[model samples]
Target: TGYGDDHTREIMRQELRERLIQAEREGRPLRVYCGYDPRTTDLHLGHTITMHKLRQFQEFGHHVIFLIGSFTSLIGDPDDVKAREILTPEKVAENAQTYKEQAFKILDPKKTEVRHNSEWLAELGFLDVIKLAQHFTVQQFLAREGFSNRLEDGNPIYLHEFFYPLMQGYDPIGLKADAQVGGQDQLFNLMAGRQLMQKLGVQPQVVIAMGESLPGTDGIEKMSKSKGNHIALLSEPGQMYTSLMKLPDFAMPLYFKLLLGWSQEDVDDMMVRINRGEVEPQEVKAGMALDITTIFHGREAALQGREFSRKAMQEGGIPDDIAEHVILSDTPLVDLLVVTGLCKSKGDAKRQIQGGGVRRDSDKVTDFDEIVRVTDLPTVLQY
Candidate 1:
């Protein structure tokens, strides 16, 4: 597929391969596109699945278009979600800028054609919109699992949500994309593109759907920054490394395959080694984190992340990256940790202090009621 090894092009189907072949034979780069909504300012591990596919397409010498959904974000996408929250134009624009910047860290900038859907979407008059709407119906969207589930659950599915797939389908037609890349959840939207193009008197392009999304540490919901269950690209090296270290061991290999672009054979071998107890899962996970961070922040940053984590764990103290609070005006130890963002909950702070996990200036504290006063020299507290 796309002149790459089999594993590298797992998502590209035979029909898509044929289309790519015809484009190559004619000395043209097949137009391929993926749409990203600006619902969040930072991209998490979840967003990288399609980004990796886009990178593979770029490596295959195809014309890759990254469409920033500035227009669609205003309407919001309810696919695989139960609720829709419309975003303001200003917020959408700001998020779009950040999305492009973070995305370019993985995608080749020179080979990538970055675009804003607002260019065409905003210019559509009533008549033009009517014509585009003629290509699909409400019944089609209701058939989607996301919508059907809401209907069965007594949840309200808004009208704007119905327009998401239509707007997405219009994106491919606007770009004249030979293929669209998306995760398996977007199969409906991807098919919507093919159908829309067919109605517009053009040949329907191929749909390239990736595997399921990478679950977060919870190993349940998709990795999402809003849920505070994401390993974000914008996170500091130390924070990113620590969060990755906390992932459930069972989810490690899946994360490696999806986020690190590890080959199927290599992943299989690692699994075999895991079964044989020859290679520790933690070691493999560390390598996975390094390979992934290296792609975005360079090998040096990856090494730094690994080293910082290793040292912190070895020392049995909080990572230096956690905020330090000056002990001013006699504050309870638990309060200090909570105020400094060191601990998320008061109960957690008390547990750490009781369990001898909390430390002040490298000395373990035995009492949760301990209070300290502010001084010129800051007290390093851990929870």
Candidate 2:
């Protein structure tokens, strides 16, 4: 999952290689970790980059820790530029509850060790925080991409924001981690962890900043839940399949590499075949969708996903894989949309229907006051 310019990428690879060798030589499993801020309930496909790496470490017999940033989520990950809406303790706890199960989508649950930062971070006294703060400077934090963007855009960067990296730095020290896996944006935070560990007289961990972020279905910016452009791991097989199929043809190779872990040569060969008309791009995308879905939903579910895509997408027919939301009693179509998690709210559902974006079977939904029926139990709401 390592990513960056060639030189930096090579350095990270070499570092990880050496660390693994040392782990074998020392006859002790190297402690490897990746931290996730529990800011949301759903674990999206984009979030699985390091999770796959952590699984690799588990395969290699290294200790893998899946750390939940219960405390950090409140402060927000400084990697994202926008000011954060701090979550309440209740909200953070609720989100954390689902992380382990969702993470099992890629990680081996039995081999993985889970933790919440609040276990230790909440106990830190002011002096303890000051001691942690001494390792980094304002200039360094400001230089980070996210903070840099905020500064250049004249956005208010809060004082606690600077402490995020420092707090993250202390994670490795607390766990005595020997390596960290993270997104490209998290290189700064991982390096901070390395520095903090070294200061504490512990060996610095190897940092693997996984490859460049995958673009959203829009095929432009990185996938973000807020942008409504991410595929959540918790999404149904049909949802995942349809989402991946939404990418531009240009991004298929990247998806093949990032999501499927295919090599450059293989991706290039596949593209060459597609360019030569030796294979249909739609058929190739269907295979890509199936491969990804199988990882989370299994082969049977994946096959269903493929069939659904072929019918709903290719033949203008309803997908058999659509979740059956039984209507025990009648309700407004808008209310059903909100209930099924298809739309964010009843108002948004009504707006979509009015804008001709929502459809039932072959008919466009034009009325917000449309009532549902038991016959519509097998309904397909397309947006």
Candidate 3:
């Protein structure tokens, strides 16, 4: 659960310890929550950080709420460098639809309580909003890096941007949350929750921070859908393998630590081996890819993904990052290949098939005339 830099990690650990002590004294289970703004349909690997922490809380017996930020998502997170387009209620609903189902991939549904902030936030009148706003001064919002940077650079800092933290703060008070899990950037917003709860004569929620924004597939900025640098949770096993395998070698230590929970000694040994040419980085990445694929897709599919990838590497014809094209059942192999643009023509597809250069996963495609089914999706085409 402590998944950040040393500084943030220590702070979160201490907070958790103190919160546990407080809960013991109070003689009740803590109400734990992690709010997710459903800005998009599918969550990437990074978004799961806090969800994992929430799952941890659920495992040992605590009230866990999967708070969907339906209203707050409309505010577009002032923490982002650029303002996000305001989404309509219908759009937000659509985006939120799959969040719980996906989150259940990590959280225990039987123990998890799902709530939409719209249930409360949407009900707030102007006067009620003003009352909430009175809790924080404009200077407080200005202190946030996102807002402050925008203001200093002469970028537009919409007056409504200040309300994001306020609304999020109200979430804990409404739920009487004893602890909250979120990304490091959200600690400030959670602080608002604490402040407001204290003002309202309720105990403040313990803030348990996680990721410092996971590195994207690009290995630069945080993994984000808008940036096209994220690996979606619903990605097929093969696709997931492809994305993990493409991460920069330098990004491995963090990925291993944060995503796979590798120890420092393990990471150091891996780096040392790579530096000494004791093992190829590609091989190490393959293991990591298989491990990750196994997590979401299970061992059998992971093995198949590994075999599919290894075959592609051996063939030297299939590019690792080809865009996927969905093909239906009973589709002729030649037709599918040509449709995918992997072959210049049916003739080319046939030639490749005849030469045994075409493959479907681990098997060589022996017949161009062979029909494919829905089960044959995520096929690897070699020249």
Clashes of each: 3, 0, 0
Q: State in Å the error of residue 131, model 3.
A: 0.6
lDDT per residue for candidate 2 within 47-146, as digits (tens), equals 8878888998899888999999988888777645677787897899998887998899899988999998888888999999988888788888777877
Which residue pairs in candidate 2 have backbone atoms (N, alpha carbon, C) closer than 3 angstroms, thus clashing? Answer: none
TM-scores, each model vs. reference: 0.79, 0.82, 0.82
Alpha carbon lDDT of residue 100, candidate 1?
77
Candidate 2: worst-modelled 10 consecutive residues by lDDT: 315-324
Global lDDT for candidate 3? 0.81
> What does candidate 1's lDDT look like per residue over 167-269, in tens digits?
8888887787898888777777777888888899888878877766889868677787667788777665655776777778788878878887678888888
Off by over 4 Å in 1: 1-12, 79-81, 314-383
Question: Candidate 3's residue-wise lDDT over 1-383, tens digit each?
Answer: 22235775676668778888888898988899999898888788888777777877888888899999999999767754667678898999999887888788788999999999998999999999988888899888887888788888888887777888899999997787888888887778877898888878887777777645679998888888878999887777777887889899988887887777788899999999999999999999989989878877789988877766565656655665656554435788789888878799998888888888887755788975688776765576544
Q: Model 3: runs farther than 4 Å from truth? A: 1-15, 25-27, 79-81, 311-319, 325-374, 380-383
- TM-score, candidate 3, is 0.82
